[model samples]
Target: MSPFWITAFLDFSADGFDDGLRFWSALTTYDVSPRRGKVGEFATLVPRDGDAFLRVQRLRDGEDRIHLDLHVSDPRSAADRAVGLGATEVADFADDGYVVMRSPGGFELCFVDHPAGVRPAPTAWPGGHSSLADQVCIDIPASSYDSERAFWRDLTGWEQRESSVSPEFSSLVRPEGQPVRLLLQRLGEQSGTVRAHLDWATTDRPAETDRHVAVGATVQEVREHWTVLTDPLGRRYCITDRDPETGVPPKPPTD
Candidate 1:
């Protein structure tokens, strides 16, 4: 099987598209790519100096959410592999060169035949804060956590590792040069469905949190080394105290 290049996407309702675009662009220091799709519903958030990894879509109907797109040389074969690994074909757009499938945890992913590229290096912001919106954290109910983690690991062929910070947190580690990383988070309690949100690994969490707030994101809650924030369009994301370059959390200070 061919390796897949992952891209994260923010799906917003038509009503929230403008705010989502403005807020995300400001947060990531990205510019909107020329709109595509018949009604101009799809656009990418192009980074200032790196390959683009984020995209936005204005859904004709449905609640706002985050999803992933797998770019491969052959969409049909990739989609077939996904199905073999417990994914269900939600929609087929092979004529258009893409297919939408639902993973076992119920997360939607699109497989496309677009050319793959290396993951762009993360960018630094003003005020000594450096980070990138390079991860999509999938929130899975405790009941489905193990299966979800396995499904993603099989689908992407990415190395799987558990986070030292929390047992419930695991990651489908991206290979070197892949832009987007998938973090599978097991919710403490059972939920009706699996969901996902964006996350940024930042050298300075406080500074990044403040910058996001200044640009229309609201601080929802603060944890030991991470802050949860709600964007202008009410979507949630996190700024964590992790190395932007390596995407690894800093080691705790010695006693």
Candidate 2:
């Protein structure tokens, strides 16, 4: 069976070997290794029933920010572990089973409660986990590799993953770990200001907005948290911090 990718990595400086080990310990319960020309390294916390990997490596001079979401069984607890590992909660909270987290590097990622954590196998879903949950990778552009990488590192506390993309397309990701991935890549005209926004599970929109604003995200539009806001660095990304019960994106105001 072909190994499918649950999460991609975010690349930062090629240092901090300890971070690599700590990351693995917190996310997966196994070893993450450099793949065979498959991009980078990969791994999983529990036993992997399908194909997944975490690619790690050092970064060059030019780079930027790449963001992704990681689904977990317990959003709150998983987030705490991330903080313990050195990542700081950016005040960005979602009522749903998800929380936005940043790595020590400048990459952005979230701890999501997938159907079965990383793998969505029906059997993978046990405890409180719903089914086979999965995090769809969403990439954000960075101004420069060093500046962006440092920003993500300070926030998430995770190190950079190695890059194996050919010269045609430049890529960066979190040093091969488990659970989720944070990736950043460089494209001549392919990169956009804001490709996509992250929507987390939440119950309240206004309340989540207040906290989100206090953390670093500036509220753009708050009809339902479906606002257009910029980060501390002026990067624009939208997020609707509303849960299913309390906040379900109101149907777009009929023009």
RMSD of each: 1.3, 17.3
lDDT of candidate model 1 versus the reference:
0.85
Report the error of model 2 at residue 170, Å: 27
TM-score of each: 0.96, 0.30
TM-score of 1: 0.96
What tens-digit string does per-residue lDDT give for candidate 1 at 1-255?
545578888999999998889888887778899999999999999876756789999999998998888888888889999989999999999889999999887899899877757577777665766788778899999998888898888878788998998887998777788787788899988855788998999887887777888998999999986899998878989988878777778888898
Winner by lDDT: 1
Tens-place lDDT per residue, model 2, 185-251, is: 3434433343322233234445544544656567666552345565544434444432232222334
Error of 1 at 99 (Å): 0.7
Residue 71 displacement in candidate 1 (angstroms) = 1.1
Badly placed stretches (over 4 Å) of model 2 are 1-5, 8-63, 67-197, 223-225, 241-255
